[model samples]
Target: MATPAHLNRVALRGRGARSNATGRFETYRSESFDDGWTEADEAARPLTTIIQPMKSRTIIARNDSPDIGFNASINPYRGCEHGCIYCYARPAHAYLGLSPGLDFESRLFFKPEAGRLLERELSKPGYKPQVIHIGGDTDPYQPQEKSLRVTRAVIETLARFSHPFTIITKSALITRDLDVLGPLGKAGLVRAAVSVTTLDRKLARSMEPRAATPERRIDAIRQLAAAGVPVTVMFAPSIPSLNDHEMEAVLQRAAEAGATSAGYVALRLPLEIGDLFQHWLRTDHPDRAKRVMSLVRQMRGGAVNNSEWGQRMTGEGPVAEVMNQRFLIARRKSGLDAPSQRMDVGSFKVPARAGDQLTLF
Candidate 1:
């Protein structure tokens, strides 16, 4: 991996990745150099966020990964603007022949016709009403979601058909759609999960630059629970030395704020994410970067990451076993050890669209 250039300071401010290296399949790599002619603070500008429409033929994606919770998922957006450094979804951007570093966050794509496409798919004659997870690959309520409202549209379509769904996000922006979520919750048709990595504001700001603050995320849980939503607090990507110590505290706070259940996932750095995260760790937290990586390897069986089934989400060995024990104890103490409520799939019905013939009973 290339060193983060000084230009990164100006151009990639508030972003997680330290360097924007080319994707793995690219033909050639590029690096930055500073010539003596350029003056300091001379017309250097931050990179602008570019938004584009993604022309996707289908909306729902199916997976057979046994480790994953849901089989069917939908993503309204192609990339996330939250810029979380430990995001496992980062490597997916490489499929578009784009850098998983800065480009993954800055250059984003949204499906403008997501609501229409979902309606058509749900209207299929043999369509089965199963639990569809939203924001499975990328956050549905990223920063741009506030203005684009693509996520809200999809939710409306789901509501019309009485489809069961679940959504997970780290953004406070989700609270803005309580009007839709409140009714879904009442019908047991929807559940929400908020990802609260840590209670320390500073650490969260550095690790997940554009995401909601820890305090705001806690507040979002409070609001969702108050609105009758069955909310789950997710302490995801639990980095061993850096944020592992805060897991119990995070669950406690969420439980107090009305979270019904809690879950966690160990840090996963697959593909290019390994390089991007290491670069950020060295640049931002040089004090404990070495120690953090050492602890991670101990959990991942002497490697930085492991992709084996059943052991990937929650690693193995002594360190990981200890963490799991701690989480179980904490979950019990926090009163969040109960299983989540199952969504109502039998209530699903195909909503009539405009210009359709009325049926007489």
Candidate 2:
């Protein structure tokens, strides 16, 4: 448990801790320094989590952003417990009147009514079925999911309504819902993608705190495939000068684990994320911090990130092109370039509401 030079009192990371850096939004959007009780005292402070219930009116969210493929999505949680330092969704916490730093992960909000809301929306007249993307912002399968079961309830709703949906998660908890996903897969109403940032256990722990181990993720992929679910592997947000080198290896391992399709997104640092990530880089890998930022800027068009639709996911430069080319080549060679399995939209059928026909099918 080492501390940063400036944050000598604060722990930079825990075992598998990825977000030890101070929250940028905590400055009240300003900067101030205090030299209280040396570094030892700061490291002694403990980390705790507080879960709150969110009363959400709707479960289905419409997205017009051309950046993502899906139009609608459902996230059962407001914040994530997986404290991945590079989570692009971190800044969203600011909208909740909270800091996007540590608060984004430690302070979580769960939507208890997600399942009912989803069912109600599905019962609406003329409601067309689309592949509702789950885990859009915060991971619906995060640790809290085990106890709250909000995500499970949403999936159950989709299954009952014959709604097509997709899942994106880094947790192995999804395997627990094989009962739900298995049927959806057979009906062609569900697909899933698991994210593996790095195959290296140590790095994986450091980069994504609280997520299942890399081995567990691969095992989850195997389990999903065994259950006949269409599984894809995602090497999301490849960090420059760090896990980027492991792209080929990650693809190979995932393919071996029964993943038929794969995709990736270059690291994205919008708003407060840039500051939080830069601080982590300097603190953990100080020697390579400067070099990493340099490469990131080169790929991001002289900025730490690019929010442009076309350039945000994949940057526009020689370096970015190289990464993309490498990925495509690896995918092709690994037989991951096969046509992606599309969710069966035609199978979507509206189900009866509470008072409607008992046989909604």
Candidate 3:
């Protein structure tokens, strides 16, 4: 899908429908022509919907990185249905022989057994609990989750075992598991972070087409906070020229919406994401595309991305420093710099094996 040529004149509306594919999720684009009108039939050219399928195994994925918070994580599904053009995980689909463009959002994978596998792993005698991050690599609450409920099952298992975990997502669907997350938060076993890239509904639609509307995401934050869930707002992958300007506004709104803490990451276009994001910028925001790339290069030491551990997340140079400073100031002003309450791992309760029941006295 090409970025609209008149992005400056474009005003986004949240009226588009979801995709209809069997195994993936999608949101169709709704365009209004230059004449300031959209025909009735033109309003519904494409129908987007979520698709899902089951997977055989799901368990722990280990990553040793100084930059990331959690060393271990779990993804209930592969290929997020959110269809964010700037997603850093898009390249992953290439390994599956899928296009990082529309195909990435249209093709999906699910690990239905994730909850069972997590139980088995947590039950092992040698298993030690550390905060397990969900939606670390791909969103746990992508659209397909509505049907598969794999993510909810994982949360249920974690709740059952009192395992500590964190979920980061852009979808309001996270609200659906409030039954599980609410109590877990009270027990200090869970925290949830909602990603808000841009507050502008139009920008959000073009940038993260398949995720929930910005208003809905804020509502999710409010609901989580009301339920006693410690909620954090994440302005992740802050594309320099495109959405960077909204940093302070996003943080402020999140604070108003009950976000206690907030964080932001500079856009990192690693591997295929570089090409994919460039394609998106050119297609959607042509006027600012060059400037955006220039600023990204300035931050990345004259490259579109830097893969080094410490430098990758924040990047380098004047542009990055300015972004960091802006975020720090905004975060401090909004009273969002306070540390989040840590999830407790000591309270884990391991379930017994199937045949281990003892006779009642």
The numbered model that scores best in TM-score is 1
Which one wins by TM-score: 2 or 3?
A: 2
Where in model 2 is the C-alpha error above 4 Å? 1-43, 353-361
**Can you write out model 3's per-residue Cα lDDT over 1-361, one digit (the tens) per residue?**
3333232222222212121111112234243233546554554344233455656654789999999888989988888767787777777766665555555676678887888888888888888899999988789988778878899889999888889999999999998989889888888999999999888998898788779989999999999999989999999988887899999999999999888999889998887677667766776788999999999999998888899999998999888999999999999999899987767989987866579886597
Ranking by lDDT: 1, 2, 3
- What's the lDDT for candidate 3? 0.79
Model 3 TM-score relative to the real fold:
0.85
- Clash totals for all models, in order? 0, 1, 7
Output the better candidate (1/2) by TM-score: 1
- Candidate 1: TM-score? 0.97
**Model 3 CA deviation exceeding 4 Å by range:** 1-58, 353-355, 358-361
True-structure lDDT of candidate 1: 0.91
lDDT of 1 by residue, 61-107 (tens): 99999898999999999878899999888998888989898889898
Candidate 3, residue 134: CA error in Å?
A: 0.4
Q: Write the per-residue lDDT of candidate 2 for residues 1-361, one digit (tens) a residue.
A: 2233443323334422234344444555533244564466555565567899989888899989988888999989987888888888888887777767777888889999999999888888888777899998989899989999999999988888788899999999999999989878877888899999998888777778789999999999999988888888999988779989999998898899898899999999898788878877876688899999999999998998889998999998999999999999989987789997677888777765568657555
10 residues in a row with least lDDT, candidate 1: 34-43
Clashing pairs in 2: 9-42
Please identify model 1 stretches exceeding 4 Å from their true place: 4-6, 37-43
lDDT over C-alpha atoms for residue 86 of model 3 = 72
Cα lDDT over the full model 2: 0.83
